[model samples]
Target: RFMCDYDEAGSIGKRYRRQDEIGTPYCVTFDFDSAEDGCVTVRDRDSMQQERVPMDQLADYIAARIQF
Candidate 1:
C-alpha cells in the first residue's frame, strides 16, 4: 500500500516539479474539488503532457503507464 505524505511547506506546482526531477512517470493531485467531481489532472513527466481523468479510475490509468 502506498501513502502520500504532503509536503506542507511546498506548493503543489513545486511538488510536481520535484517528482519530475526524481523521474516520477506521472503525478496525481487530489484537490478539494476532486472529491465532488471525481476527476483530476494527470501530468506526464517526460513529455510534459497533462490530461484530466476520473479519480474513480485513476489507479488503473496510472498503473497502465507504469508498465510502459
Candidate 2:
C-alpha cells in the first residue's frame, strides 16, 4: 500500500524539504494553474527534478516508478 500526506503549512519549497527529509520519493503539487490545466507538478526527491503531469494519468505514472 502507498501513503499520501497533505501539507499546506508552509511555502512550497519548505513543504518539499519537509517531505524530502522523510524520504518521500515524490511530491505532487497542485497549484492555481492546475485548476485550469488539470496538471500537477511532480517533484522527484533524489533527482530534484520537476515535471508537469496530467491529473488523469497520474496514478499510472506514479505506479510505474514507485517501489514497495
Candidate 1 matches the true fold with a TM-score of 0.74
Q: How large an RMSD does model 2 have?
A: 0.9
Tens digits of per-residue lDDT for model 2, 1-68: 45899999989999999999999999999999999999999999999999999999898889999977
Query: In candidate 1, which residue pairs clash?
Result: none
Candidate 1: residue 65 lDDT (0-100): 74
Best by TM-score: 2
User: After aligning candidate 2 to the native by TM-score, how far in Å is the CA of 57 from where it should be?
Assistant: 0.5
Query: Alpha-carbon error at 1 in model 1, in Å?
Result: 6.6
Could you tally the backbone clashes for each prediction? 0, 0
The number of the candidate with the highest lDDT is 2
